[model samples]
Target: MGRQYAVIGTGAIGGFYGACLQKAGLDVHFLLRRDYDYVKEHGLAISSTFGDFTLPQVNAYNQVENMPPCDVVLIALKTTQNHLLPHLLPPLLKPGTVVITLQNGLGVEPEIATIVGETAQVLGGLCFVCSNKIGLGQIHHLDYGQIQLGAYGNNHQPQGITPTMRQIAADFEQANIPIQLAENLLLARWKKLVWNIPYNGLSVVLDATTDAMMKDSYGYQLSEQLMREVIAGAAGYGLEIKESFIQKMLDYTMKMKPYRTSMKIDYDCHRPLEVEAMFGNPMRAAQAVGVAVPQITMLYQQLKFLDARNIAIGN
Candidate 1:
């Protein structure tokens, strides 16, 4: 049989990619939360700049135990909901199941290892897609759907490109999704953070879209500064991200569609911002290595306060 797949947390990221994998004629199951009933009745819809398609029917489940054990499990849940993993993972896992975490932030893979143990292999998938859940059972893919994947050892060290990594890459490539295999997982996370930190943080704090941020003078300069701080922090942690990446990401963002960040969207929807995963962990990592990132530290402090205030006020 072909690879059996399970997608937990079928929101924007999970729903979009899981739909793509299913469209590839693979046997894919989606374990949904809020959108479960709607998707179960009407199926999932993806509106993408590349093209638009709708699946009339999908193997959808409301609970993890209702799904069968699968060969690959794609976790697309928010890091905030990760406390449920110890309870959620046991039902859908089996021997030789490869768990791929498609969540944001650092230090995620090791956390999965602690729960899944040696029975299942875990990988980190850093998605560069900009998409959102516009409604129940709907995903809007704006631009960029490339994924960078890395292998994680039991101790969470980078194991370089392995056979399983290559196979998964081929599988994604077959589905017409761009895939990059990273020999170093930490470095890949740091590189993605170079873009995420500035864009996600500023979009919420300044209340602007990415294009608007790039167009304005203060926004442009501060974003550049934050990018530089990310580079410094990574280097201090012995994961040296190149200085050239800043300009590369800047140029890319300048040409992209005028878009709101995920964090900004979460804030608008009253969902809790991933303050700890995106900022807290990185700031603490830098401090552990005696690296001072004043700009990032300030952003972290501001975002933490804002997040707390939003949560306290029920928004």
Candidate 2:
């Protein structure tokens, strides 16, 4: 008997990864919202840089109560929908279930820890993939599909690599998805923000993609400046993010395919942007330690205003 997996939100992250796991012969059950009926009947289609494939039959469910308890549960929902976790998670928990949150921004694991309490192991998965749900039951993978897994610690300290992390890594590796285990989850979260903050936010505000931003002089310099501020903010928590990492991120974006960020997509769709998770929380964290992130603060304010107006106008 192999490990049974449950994907809580089968959007881009969950749908792509869960489909990969299932294609590799792993038992992956997907819990969907809007796409449940379509996927349940027609299955999932994935077009990726690695290759294109389809799952003709998926263990799809619309409600968690109808799904079986699994060894691993992947939560891929937007942080904004986290309020529903209390109702959606309990039914899928048995003993010793490993709940990995494939969400962006800070304070995710802590919130999950409170929900599951001591009943399950909490891990944070920082996904570095550029994917989007192009249509119902369809996911388009643009570039860079790798995940870094770290165990959540008390007060967001370093937990080091653990057996559970290795166990889950093996599962993903078997599915041909790249995995890296982090010694410090907090540091990894901040490191992800170094890329996410500038790219995701600026994509919406500037109404451009990565290529547009990287190619223009103003966009490029502003991105570098924001990256530096994020690096400085991380230092307030005693986390060392090397100056060279900024160039690495910039270089990565330069080579990536022209792509709209998840935040930008949300904004364009009139959906709520993850302003708080990606920007608000990071800015407040920096301010807590007296680290001033004026640029990040300004970006955060811009995003909040834009996000609210976009939703209110329904456009």
Candidate 3:
């Protein structure tokens, strides 16, 4: 029998990738909240740079309990919602199931491991994609969509590529989404932070998209400095991220479409920003290692204030 996949969060990241897998003929069951009714009746619409397609019929469930146990489960919710995973994940687990967290920030896989326990394998999926849920059951993919998969190891050590990782990668590859296998999940998470820390935070604070940040002299320079601090933080943990990678990310952003980052979008909509996951956890980790990240610290504090105030007023 083929792998039965469960997508835990049917938002932008989960919906886009799950639809791709289903489009490739995989059995993908989606667990949704608000869009459950619309998607069940109208299916999913994906507008992407790769191409555009629609899933006229999908296996959609409003709750995880209604979904079947599967070989793989993809958790694509923002880190802010992860607290609910303890309640949302159990119903979708089977023996030997592999849970892949397609989330940003450090220390995510560990929390997932605690929830699923010893019966499942946990992996970290680093998504370098620019995607957003534009409307109910609609996701617009503007730019890159490659994922880096790595095995979670004890004490944050490298696990090397495992058989399970290869199997998951094969499924994503068959769906026409690019995949990179990382031997060190910790290193990959840190590398992703290099891009995320600067753009996601600055976009909200500066009230600008990536293009504007890259165009203006001050914005561009500030981004570079934050990137360096993130790199230094990684080094404090014995992970080496080269300085040249900073320019590579900057160049990539320069070429990307004028886009609002996920954090910025959340701020605009009065939805909770992932202040702790995307910013707090990383900044605290760096501090724990005796690395001072003044810029990241300030950014985290500012986002915290804004996120709290925005949500309070919205409520």
Candidate 4:
């Protein structure tokens, strides 16, 4: 039997990985809604700048009940759906099931670990992909579709995960993609957080591309400052993300020329946004460490108001 895997939320991240693994001949399933029905009729359609392929038919579900026990569960839902995990996770999990969480908010590792326990392995991931869901079973690839996963089992520890993580890394490496067992996964998460916390909000507020928004005098300085504050707060918690790390982040941002944060995409579609996923958690962390994240706090509040107003207006 092939390695059975299931992906919850067939959006860009989950859909991309599922399609890859399925194309590689592994048994993969998806939990979706009407998208599943559309995909059932139209199949999985992926069109990328690099290439395009169409899967005639792929498995998908409208609810958690339709899922079967799987060896691995990739959770890729928006951060706004974090609370829904407690109700949805139990049915699909069993002892030895690995639940890989690719969610965006901060401090979710612990919550997931607490809920899933020894029955499932909770791992964190950072996805560099900037994609959009163009249609059911169709994800429009923009750029930077790479992923890095934490090797730690839970709470940033390596216990009970060396062999499995090595296998995962090897499998991904053989798949001809950049995959690594991060030495300091927490720091990696923090670095990625620096990109999201400010950039996501900045893009939504300014309604601009990364290069257009970030290249300007004001946006550039503000983004860097917000990143510094976040890094300092991380340092207070004993995670020292060095200056070099920040420089690399800037390098990555520069490459995202026409980039728009995922939240910005959500804003454009007038759909529900994951403000708490990228913004709520970081500001909470800064407060916990006594870091004065005045700019970040201000940005978060402004975006929160906008998101809330949109939600209230039933947009």
TM-score, per-candidate, Cα-based: 0.96, 0.97, 0.97, 0.93
lDDT of each residue in 225-275, candidate 1, tens digit only: 999998998898688878888999999999988988999988887788988
Error of 2 at 309 (Å): 1.0
TM-score, model 1 to reference = 0.96
Q: Pick the candidate with the highest lDDT.
A: 2
Predicted candidate 3 versus true structure: per-residue lDDT over 17-97, tens digit per residue = 999999988999999999999999999999999899999999999978788999999999989999999998898888999
Q: What does candidate 4's lDDT look like per residue over 117-154, in tens digits?
A: 77887777778777788876888877766677775445
- lDDT per residue for candidate 2 within 1-315, as digits (tens), equals 578999999999999999999988899999999998999999999999989999989999998899998899999999999999999999889899999999999888988999999889999999989899999999998888999999997788799999999999999999999999999999999999999999999999999999999999999999999999999999999999999999999998899888889999999899998888899999999999999999999999999999999999995
Rank by lDDT, descending? 2, 3, 1, 4
RMSD for all candidates, in order, please: 1.4, 1.2, 1.2, 2.0
Better of 1 and 4 by TM-score: 1
Q: Deviation in angstroms for 263 in model 4?
A: 0.9
Residue 39, candidate 2: C-alpha displacement in angstroms: 1.2
Cα distance off (Å), candidate 2, residue 267: 1.3
Q: Which ranges of candidate 2 are over 4 A from the true structure?
A: none
